[model samples]
Every structure is written in structure tokens, then in C-alpha cells.
Target: MAEEKLPTRAEDFAEWYNQLVVRADLADYAPVRGCMVVKPYGWALWENITSWLDGEFKKTGHVNAAFPTLIPMSFFEKEKEHVEGFAPELAVVTHGGGVELEEKLAVRPTSETIIGHMYSKWVKSWRDLPLLIVQWGSVLRWEMRTKLFLRTTEFYWHEGHTAHVSEEEAKEEMYRILDIYERFCFEEAAIPVLKGTKSETERFAGAQITTSIEAMMWDKRALQSGTSHYFGDNFAKAFEIQFLNKDNKLTFAQTTSWAISSRIIGAMIMVHGDDNGLVLPPRLAPIQAVVVPIFKNDAEKEKVMEVADRIFAELKTAGIRIKMDDRDNVSSGFKFNDWEMRGVPVRVEIGPKDVEKGSVALARRDKPGREGKTFVPQAGLDSAVSDLLADIQASLLKRATEYRDANIHNVEDFEELKQVVQDGWAFSYWCESRECETKVKEEAKATTRNIPFNQPDTEGTCVVCGKPSKRKAYFAKAY
Candidate 1:
């Protein structure tokens, strides 16, 4: 069969993304428009994500639960602003069992509405101050623009909702979830992110504060990896989620919720993938390392298999996700292309020449710029491959950090801010006026994405209106 070729990233970024997702055998468009069918490889990657994220949620004292997919329209109206913001995107069901229903139920655009209704009932006393619940499931939104995992009609995500006694505690909880999300994406996924709070106009519906961890894609567009909301009694008041305090006073409790979805899968593809295909981090890669046993003929096949099986067994015992390529129909060159396309962090090739020479060839998928890969001696192949995986993980993070640093810049004026925002993040002094925020967005096509946590008051005029500055806002054109 002929090799299927696709558009190069330089040819067109959008085309490159679409080609990579399908060509890598990750996902396919389902019969439903704007929705995708995650193939085995893509689902396996998501399984890896949920496994790690669920463990983190458990470590943070959150319990997992399932919620019904369809929610009553009345439940959505409980939160006033929430309903208005989400009403347009909702997919509602008006009939059940071929009969018209009295009240229409909407497929959850987000679980906040349904979950808020449950939260009201789940709490009644001071003892229920902190009701932490998490759910992992698929959600539907009538999306107009869909790009595989980037933006889909139906996508899987793990959302966490926590209720608390006061706004102070809720803020802390919001930041805590942000920390967990940052750790998961940056540390495990090897994607660098910028931590900041979104501007009022960009904040989540009904949230007092919205904090996000934003990562820039290879296309220079920002991908919102995860978001945490500090809802200060807004949902509680709407849904009547009140509890008796220690002094027997009825108070509307505070709530916070956060989520990281399969969107990270899209971010991962854009950040690390190349013309070849997806380059997943070793820690998150479905197959960390693939052993491609090179054999010249039948004389060497049995011996190579013995060595390959031994290496695979050792890695498996070490709790590594490993694969061994033992097919006889394909040549070593074809196997190399296949594994590289899948972006296995490490590939070990052992053949008759290496078996006789007591050395094996090792290849790092990332270091292609090094001309060619170096060999791993038989006595040291196992240890060397382990070290290579670690190096690849660290190298990817370092590369992305440099990209982030290069893209993020401080702008002194409107023109400077406009140019900076086109490429990446621009931290500029803002007058803290809603009008100026709107102006920046209107003229530059960039919004006030966030007010960074670490930024202190500075002596500078507003980048847009040249008024007294309130905060240094990070502006960017987002996904």
C-alpha cells in the first residue's frame, strides 16, 4: 500500500491539525455533525489523562459521582446569568419515548446548572460546609466551529465542583484546582502554561472570579487548558443552597468549580507535534517506548524476538507502557516511520549486526535535529533507553518554555500591545476601566485575557486610554 501523505504545518496550520488528528489514527468525525469518534488510540490517551486527574482529585479529598446527562430547563433558570450565557449553545430534548414532554430537558452544555441544583439539596448544616464532588463524562454543546478534539459537539471532560462556607475559602479552593491542573499539564504533559485570572468580561458566567491556565499552541493561538471559578454565593443564592452556620445563622454558602477536558489533547497536538505526527510526552504517551526488532532474515528473527521479549518484560515490570513490533511483513524502515508517526519517545532497534556486536541502536524521536541517533550498547541499552525517555520529557518542556518566553512580551503602548498580542501574551498596564478593556479588544482583536497573580501595581499609563493604571493585564487572542 502507498503511504498516505498530508499537508505540512508550514503549508497551512488548520490543515496540518486536521491531517495530523486523522493521519495519526487518533480520532474521526462521527455521524453526528461537529462531534468526533475517538478511535482506540485517542480513547487510550484520554484514559491515561482521567487516570492521572482522578488520582489528583482523590488526593485532594474529592469524591467521584455521576449525574444524569439531561437536565430540566427549570434547573438552568435557577442561576440567572448562567442560563443567559449558556442558553444559545444548549441542545434541548422536547420529546421522550415518542411523546411530547411538558418540560424540555437540555443536554448539559456544562454540568453547573444540574450540579448546582443537587448542591442545594446536598447541604443543610454547617457540617456540610465543604461538599466536594467530581464527575467525568461526555457533554454536548451545539458548537458552530469544530476542530476534532479542539472544539467538538460532544466531548469528555472531568469537572470538579466544591462548596464552601465563605468566599475566602472558595478563592483558595479555586487556586488549589489551578495548581493541580497546572501540575498535570506542565509536569506530566510537558506543556508550559501561564497562570492568571481572567478579566471581568472574559470571566465565567456567574463567577465572582475566573482563573485559568493558558498554554499557547504552535499556531500562536492560546488554548485554555483549564479554568477554575470562584462563585461567591451567586449559584447558592440562585439555587437556594444555604446552610446553617455555627451560630445558627442561615447563610448562602460559597462554591467553586473547575475542569480540564479533552481540549488538552488538542493543545498537546498543536504544541509538540510536527510534520511527522504527534509527539507525546513519555509520561503521558500511550506507548512510552516501542521496541522495533530489526532482522535481516529468518536466521536472526528468533534471536531478535528473544531479546525483544526480554526487554519488553523488563519495562513492563517497571510499570512502563511499552510496545514490541514483531510483524514480519514490514521492513525496519516502515516500522521506524510507523513508530515515529505515533511519536513514541524512545525506539530500540536490535538486529543481527548489533546482536553479534553486543550493542543495540537507540533513537530519540525528539532529537532528529542531531543529524541521526546514536547507538546503545547491549550491556547498557535498558538503562540508556530509560535515561533517553527522561531527557525527551525534560527537553520538550524546555523547548515550550522558550517558546512561551519568546512570545510573551511587555508592551508600552497600544501599537506595541497590538503587535505583541498578535503573536502571544502581552502584559500591559490597564486603567481598570471596562470601557478601556472593550476598546483594547475592539481595536486590536485581543481581549484582556487575565490579570496575572504575581503582577503588582506599576507606575505606568494604561496601554489603551493612557489613564492611571489599575492592573497589568495580560492580553492575548485566545482559542
Candidate 2:
């Protein structure tokens, strides 16, 4: 049988992405507008991501909590900036029991306001300082445009809210989370990132600092994989979240919040997936390895099957996620294409030929080959997979690191900066002026993605106005 053909990315990246997402059967458009139905495969991938992230959070002393998805409009009105930033994207629920309610309740675009209301009632003393909590739940935003896993109306995410006694501690949480985020992406997802802080114009509303990890995709566009924000007593003041110290002084608590959502799935799709199909990092792949059997006659089949069974048992005992595909109806070629599309990180091929040779063919999804593929002797299968997985993980990170470098352009003039950012990101000396920011955005459909953290305080003129600039900032047209 002929293998199914996949859409070429060069033909149209947007269409190709859509085709790969739906064709791979990972997810589908939901009945309700702007929502997505994550299929078993897709949900399995998310589970893998969440399981890993949850452990990481626990290691950092962040406890998981639950929060409701609805928030009363009155709660939003308490924070001036939070209200303005999210009001436009809120979904209002005005009826209950088929009757109009007295007050409208906004479906959460975020939980800061609702969670803040609860904090006001719960916090009573300095001992409650550094209240660290995280929640994994669904959030709704009335998005104008929705992609499979990028900007859907409703998506699952882990949102963390922490309260501290001082602004410095609050800000410290932001950087700490940023570090975890960068390490997670590069180490687990195998996607390299540029870490930075958002400019005032682009910072989360009511946040004093917004730190982010930005990754470049195949389309030359940047995807914000994660963010950490410092509110610094802003929400505390708005919600009257105060505690009394031993000095007998009542002080509003400082707060910080951060999140990484299903959007990281989209980033992984764009970063590692190619024209053929999905190319997942081994650590993130739901099915780490699949075993496909090949046979000819009854004698050959029995011999291959016996070896396959033994090999599968050994791999499982070694703590590997292994699947045995013995469907006799379909040819092995079809299985190869399907599994490749779904991004099974490794494949073990056992056939009559391999049984006689006392070895099996090993194929890696991320690193495709055109010539005679490699194999590992039966005794070496376990060790070979361990080495291959580590190599693929590092390979993906190196590839993305190169893409990030290639897309980032440092322009000295406004006109060049505008041209450069159209395709991807541009870094240039910025004066940190909102008016200057507005001028740049007006001329180019780009915003400051971030003021890079710990960048050299280079002495250079602003790309737009020729005035002295203190720091360099990354500008990009984002997803």
C-alpha cells in the first residue's frame, strides 16, 4: 500500500499546520465555536507535559489548588488595570435558571481578580507570607481567532499565584519561575528560548514585571511559551489583602503569578515538527517507542513473534513505554507513516530477517534517514535507546537554538527594524518610552516582545529616534 502524503510546510505553513494537527487525529474543532476537542493522543501528550511540570512545581515547593472558572464582574472592577486588560476578552454569563441574573458574571480570562478576592479573606498575619499556590484548570477567553492549540477560546493551564511580604520577594518569584520555565522548555521540550521581561506597553496589566520565555517557530514567528509576572502589592491593595506584622503595622501583601498553557503544545508542533509529520522530543512523546512486526511464512512469523514478545517484555521491565503493532491487515509502511505523524520517538522493527540476525532495526522519528537505517543487536537495544533518546533531545534544542539566532536581527534604523520584524523578531536599542513604543508599533505591526534580562547596558542610540538608549529590546510579530 502507498503511504499517505502530508502537506508540505513550504506550500503554506498555516494550512500545513492545520492539516497535520487534524490529519494526525490529535485534536479536532469542537462543536462550540473557538473551542477544541483534544483527542486521546493529544490529551495524552498534555498529560505527559502536566505530569512533568507538576513534579517540577512540587520540587520548587509550589502546592496545587483548585479555583472556580467563573468570577463576578464586581471582583474585576476592583483592579483598574486588570479590568481594562481582560474586560475586552471576557465571556459574560447573565442568566441562571432561564432568568436574567442581577449582576453579570464574567467567565475568567484569568483568575487574578477572583483568587484575589479569596486571598483578602484568607490572609490574616505575616505567617501567611509567601503563600505559594498553583492551579491547573480551564480558562475561557473570547478570542477573535482560534488555532488548534495556540489561541483557542478555552484551554487547560497551570496558573500559579503567590503572595509575599515584600516587593523584592515578589519580583524574585518572577525570575525563579522564569528560570524553571526556560529549563523546562530546553530540557524537557527540547526547545531553546530567549528569556526576558516585557516592556510597560506589553506587560500584563496590573503587573510590575512580566518575564517570559520566547521560542522561534519554523515560520520565523516567535511563540511565548511561558510567562511569570510580579504584581507587587497591586492586587493586594485592590483586594484589601493585608496582614499585620509584629511591629503592629498593617501592610498589603505583595503577589506574583505565572503560567504555561496548551500553547506550549503549539510551540512544540512548530519547533520540532517538519514537512513530513510531527517530530517529538523523546521525553515529551507519549509513546516513547513502538514495535512493528514483519513476517512472511508461518515459521518466520513464529520466530519473529517470539523474539518480539521477549524484546517487548525486556523494554517494559526497563521502564520504557512500548507498543507492539501486530496488525496483519495493514502493511508496515502505513504504520510507519501514521506513527511518524503522531511522533513516536523511537521505533523497533522486528522481522524474520532480524530474528535470524539476532538484531532489530532502530528508527528515530526526529532524525529521519534516506539510506540503509541503523540497528542494534538484541543485547544492545536497551542501552541504544537510552543513548538515542538523549541525543534526540539535545538535537532538538540545538536546532531551535540555531533558529532563534537566525531570526533575531539587530537593526539600527526604524525602517530596517520594521522590515526585519515582519518575518520574525528584531532586537534593537530602545529608550523604554511608551511614546517611542507607539511610534514603532504604528509603523510596524510589531510590539516589544521583551526587554531581555541581564543584557549588557550597551551604549547605543534608539533605532527610531536616534536618542540614547539604555537597554536593548526584542520586537516581534507574535502568534
Candidate 3:
């Protein structure tokens, strides 16, 4: 079978993304509609993310716990706004053992209701005021328009839920988690993002405020990478989660929920992937460095494999995820392309001649062509590989940030906003009214991404309604 070349991203970004994902052995469409079979490589990437975030959660006094995937319909109904928001996407189980259920069960879309119910039962006094728990599980949302990992019907994610005695504590937890999410995007995923509170219409249902980290993809579309919501006393009151205070007075608990999903994999693909294939960050790449032995005959193979094996062992001992490609049947060029397609951070090629010189040729995935390929001595190869991988990780984030910053435009009118959003992000003063937000969306197919928290304070008229504006909002077409 012949290998397929991915469509050029510049010509057709969507097709390019779809092809690269499968071609690179990340994931594939599942037998069920709107679902994806996350391949082993894809799962490994997710595992790396899960392990890191799980540690962060633990460090912040949060512990892992499991919640039932099946939530009673009555539980969802306890919170009217949440039920209304998730009703359309809920996958209800009406029957069990061939008998109709008395009350339908919903496959978990988000675990707020079930978790809230559990919290209400567990909390009774001020001593149990702060309940911090994290659930790593799959959620089913019946998305009408699915796009692999980005919008799959069943997606893997971690939802963090907490209960506090005071509203200030809940808000603090929300921002703390949001800061961690922003850090993960920039430090681990090599994607730069804007962090801020979502507009009223864009806030999560039943949330008093929603804060998110939004990233710009290569196509100039926004991707909501992760979100943290402050629910105040809304869900606690609805679910009857109450606690007696130090003063011996009962009050509703303040609640917060924050989540990050497999959709981040899609963001990484769009941000760093090129026409050749994926360009993974060193921190998350399943195989950080791959050793491809170059040989033309058995004699050459014996010489190259010896060095390749040694280098692989050394890198492994150095705590790097390294692989040695010693298959004699495959050509060296084929192995190179295979590793490149997989987005291994560094490729070390050891050939007979290079071995004779006591050195190895190194190539980086983030840079184009032979320009990124260099020769390093075998004596200090471990440090060389480490330095190169670090450079690649930093460079990818730098490149993405440059692209995102250059494309963001400040516009004063709706027409300018529409024109700017066609290619990139539009920053304009917004009236903070749903009517103006809806008009912008209906007219330009763009929505306010967020009201950036750190943007400078300025006074101007609304881009849509010409009304007095409270703050500048980012408007962009999003994934």
C-alpha cells in the first residue's frame, strides 16, 4: 500500500487536519457515529496530560474520586438552568433489561448535578465546608456536528468540583484552576492563549462567571482550550447543599467546576502541525526522540545498529522517551518519514560513516528541511538531544504566539470587525449586552471570544450598537 500525502493546510486546513490525525496514528473514526477510537499513541499523549494535571490537582488539596456515569433525570432537574442547557445534548437511557425505566438516566455530559447531589448528602456542617474532588472520565454529549477529538460524541476529560463555605473561596479556586490551565497550554502544549472571563452569553449555564483559556489555531480560529466556572451558591442551593457555619447558622455552600478535555489534542494539532505532518511539543510527544539506524547492507547495519542501540539506551537512562528503529526490512528514508509523521521531537540518525566518525546526525521536527538537521558528537549526545528538544518546545510556542499576536486587530466599527474576523481576531469595545453580541454573531458569523482580563481600560462606543462600552472583547470565528 502506498502512503498518502496530507492535503496542504493552506489550501484546505480541515482536510489536512483530518488526514494528519489518522495518518499519524493518533485516532480514527469509531464504528459508532460521532465517536473516535483513540489510538494507543493518542492515548499516551492524553496520559501524559492526565498525569501532570492530576499532580497539580493533588498539590492544590484536591483528590481523585469516581462518580457514576449514569445520573438520574431528577438530579438534573434540581438545577433548572443546567437541565435546560444540557437537555438537547443529553443521551438518555430509557430502558434497562428490556423494561422501561421509571425515571430516565442521562449519560454524563458534565458531572455537576451528580457531584452536587453527592456533596449535598456528604456536607452537614462547617467542618466539611470545602470538598475538593476530581473525576477523570468520559462524557457523552450528542454533538450534531462532530470533528474527531475536537467535538466527539464521547470524549475523555477531567472535571474538578469543589464546595466551599464562602463565595470568595469558590472564586479563588476557579482562578487558581484557570491559571493552571493557562500554564499547561503555554508550557506543555506549546500553544499561547488568552485568559479571561467569558461574556454573559458565552458563560457556562448555571455559572455565575466562567473563565477560560482560548488559543488561536493556525487557521486563525479560536479554540476554547479549557474553562473554570464559579457557581457561587446556585448549584448548592438547587441541590440543597448546606453547611452550618461557625456562628451555628446554616447557609448554602459555594461551588466551582473546571474542566479540560481531549479537545486540547485538536488545538495542538492545529497550532503546530505542518504540511508534512504533526509537530508535537517535546513535553507531550509519546516518543521524544527516535533513533533511525541508516544502513545499505548487513555490514553497515551491524555498525549503525550498534551505535543506535547505545544512543537509545543512553537517552532512555537519561529519562527521555526514546525509540530505536532497527527493522532491517524498512529503508532508512522510510523510517525517517515515519518518525517525522509521528512528530517525534528529535530524530537521531546513525549511519556507518557517521559511526566511524564517532558522531550522529540530529534533525528536529519543528524546523523545516535540512536547515534543522545538525551533527553532534557521540560523547555528549544526551545533552545535545536534551538541549534540542527544549529548543523545539520553546520555539513552537514562540512561533504560535507570533502568529496569534500579528493577526489580532483592533477595529472601531461592525464592518471593520466583520472584515478583520474573516482572517484573524477582532478586538473591539462591546456594550456587554446580549442584543449587540447576537447582532455581531448573526451578521459576521463571529462571537466574542472573551473579555480579556488584562487588556487596558479604555472608553469607546460599542462596535455593533454604538452604545457606551464597558470593556473590549475579542471577537473571532472559532472551532
Candidate 4:
């Protein structure tokens, strides 16, 4: 089948993203509305993402555990703010096994309520204070509108919940997890994200403080990639998670919860992808390099395959994720486009000519066409490919960072903030009041992304109300 051209991002970014998700074979719309089926290729990508994060969590004294999928409906009621925030999205099970249940069970939109209940029962002394656990699973929420990975009804994530005896320890754990999230985005995903505190309205329900790593997509829209929240004995009190302190006094535990979800896959697509397809970062790409043997006939194929197999084996031995595409049915051009669409970082083409010349052609997915093509000797091909992959990784990060920095503007007044948020992010002084925040969202169609930790030494007037403001915040249209 002939491949259909995708709509350019400039032509229609929404359509481009929707089409690319399926065309690239990452995921497909499920039979159920607002659900998606992640294909094998996509699952492989997710595995890499999870493996890295799982290791980091373990390194920080967090252990993986499982929680029940069905939570008691009454559990949510224990925390008023959390229940109020998630009420509309809860999917309750009122019937089971052809019988009407005494009380409804909620398909967990999140495990906070259930997990909190368990913590209350498990903790009885200061020795068991720091209960650090991470759960990896899928969650369901009754979302009205959904995008494949960005805002689906059911999505995959790792939700980490921890408890400590002191507020200092709980807050420290929250910041530590956020730092891990920021590092993962920058190092493994090659996306430059801003780490900051969420405003009161945007903070997670029942959390005393919420922080996130926000990224700028290709269209200059913001994506809240990951979040870490600190609950200062809020859930503890509701769940009655009391423990005997070192001073022999009963005290509520300080708690924190954080996550980096599949929504991050959406951010990667928007941040690094082109009109052609996905541009996955090398460290996270399932297939880092693919070998395409180019030949016209059986004799030529034999010669190219001999060299191609050697290069593939060498690269794989060097700890590179490599694939050998030796299909005889499809044209080499078709194979080229296929891998490009999947965003393999490097493509090594070995034809009869290349075999004779003792060299192979290398094509970079990040830079398509002739500009990215190079011919390197096969004598030390493994080293050459490694260096090229590293270069491409760095180049992608640099290009994306420049794009994000250029589009973020410092606005002096409401008019400038409104105009800037139309196409990019507006960084301006804010009075940090709900009325001012609501006014900007109502008029400009932009919301406060975050109040960044970094700030100016001198205070300024609020962009909206002209009132004295201490710090600035990012305002932008978001996905």
C-alpha cells in the first residue's frame, strides 16, 4: 500500500498529531470510546521509559507494590477536597455478579484514598514512619474529551506515595522526586522542561503544595509532563494515620504523592516530532539503529547482507538497540520511509556499491534527506554510529531548547501578556490571587502553568491588576 502524506503541523497540528499516533504504529483507537490500544512497538518504548524510572525510584528507597483496583466509595469521602475534585470522574460499580451491592465500589481514578486507608492501619510507631512505596498500573477517569495518550479515559503511570514523621522529611521527598522527573525529561527524553511550583488553583486536591515540570510543545503550547505533591498531614488526618513519635506523642504522618505518566509520551511527540512523524530521543528509542540492505538481485543481496549482518551484530554487541530490515518484497525507499516514520535515530544502508567500497550510508532521522546522510567506513562502524547517535541526541536537545527559549516572552502589561500567549508563553509578575488568575484565563484562553523557583531580586507590579507582586509565573495555552 502506498503511504499517505500527513498534514503538516502548521496546516493543522491537531490532525497531524492524531494521524501520526496511528500512522507511526505507536497506538490505535480502541473499540471503546476514549480508550487506546498500545501496539507492540509502543509498548517497547514504554518499557524503556518505565525501566529507567523504576530503577531511579528503587535507588531512592522506594519499593514497588500493588493496590486494589476497586476502592470503597466511602474511602473517597474521607478526604473532602480530593473527593470533590474527582467526583465527576469516578466510575462506580453498583452491581457485581448479578447482585446489587450494599455500597458502590469506585474504579480507582487514583489510589490516594485506598492507599491512605492502608497506611492508617499499617502505621503505629515512629519506627514505621517513612513508608515509601510506588505503584505501577493503569487508572480510569470518565474524561469527556480524550486524545490518544495525552488525555485518555484510562492511562498508565507510576503513582508514588510516601509518609514521614516530620514535615521536613515529607517535603524533602517531594522535591527529590521532582528532581528525578526533571532529570529524566532532560537526559533520557531530550526535552527541556521548567521545574516550578503550581499555583493554588492548579495544585492537586488535598495537597498543601504541588510542583511540576512543564514543557513547551512544537506549537508553543505547554504540557505539564510530571507532578510531585506534598500533603502536610491533610490525608494523614483524614485517614487517621497516627503514630507514636520519638517523643512518645501521637502525631499525624506527613505525606507526599508524585507521578510521571504516559502523558509524557505525548509531550515527546510534540516537542521533537516533525511533519513526517515522531522524532524519538535516542536513549529512549526502542530501535536506535536499523540496517537496510540495498540490492537489485540475489547476487547483490548476498554481498550486501554479508556486510549488513556484520555491522548489525557489531552494533548490537556494543549495547546498541539494532534491527536488520532485509525484506525482499518492499522497495528500499519504502523501508527508508517506514523507519523514518518510526523515528529510529540512525539508518545504515549497505548496498552492492557500499559492500565493495567497504562503507555504509548513515541517515539521521532528526535531519531528513541529504543533509543528514553520511558515508562511513565499515572498519570501525560501531564507534562511528555511536558517536552519530550521541550527536543527534545533543542536537535535538539544543534545537528544542532554543525553540522554547525564543518563544517565551517577558510581558510588562496585560495587553502584552494577552498577545504573547496567543502564540507562545508569557512570563509576567502576578499578584497570585484567584480573581486575577481567573480573569486571564477567561479573557486570554491561557492558564497559569507554574510559578518557577527562579525569580527576580526586585518585586514588580502585577501584569493584570497593577498590584505589587513578588514573583512571576508562566501563562500559556495548554494541551
Angstrom error at residue 211, model 2: 1.1
The lDDT per prediction is: 0.85, 0.87, 0.92, 0.94
| Candidate 1 segments whose C-alpha is farther than 4 A from its true place | 1-3, 369-372
True-structure RMSD, every candidate: 1.6, 1.7, 1.0, 0.8
Could you tell which candidate, 1 or 3, scores higher by TM-score? Answer: 3
Candidate 4 structure quality by residue, lDDT tens digits, 1-479: 34567789999999999989898899999999999999998889999999999999999999999999999899999898999999899889999999999999999999999999999999999999799999999999999999999999999999999999999999999999999999999999999999999999999988999999999999999999999999999999999999999899999999999999899999999999997788999999999999999999888888888888888999999999999998989999989888888889999999998988999999999998667899989998889989989998999999999999999999979998989999999999999999999999999999999999989898998999999999999999998
Those runs of model 4 whose alpha carbons end farther than 4 Å from true positions after fitting are: 1-3
Q: Candidate 2 lDDT, tens digit per residue, 189-293?
A: 999888998888778989988889988889888788899999988999999999997687999999999999999999999999987788888888888888998
Clashing pairs in 4: none
Task: Let me know the TM-score candidate 1 reaches against the reference structure.
Answer: 0.97
- Return whichever of 1 and 2 wins on lDDT: 2
Residue 63 local lDDT, model 2: 95
Error of 4 at 221 (Å): 0.8
Q: How high is each candidate's TM-score? A: 0.97, 0.97, 0.98, 0.99
Q: In model 3, what is the error at residue 139, expressed in angstroms?
A: 0.6
Q: Which one wins on TM-score?
A: 4
TM-score of 3: 0.98
Model 3 segments more than 4 A misplaced: 1-3
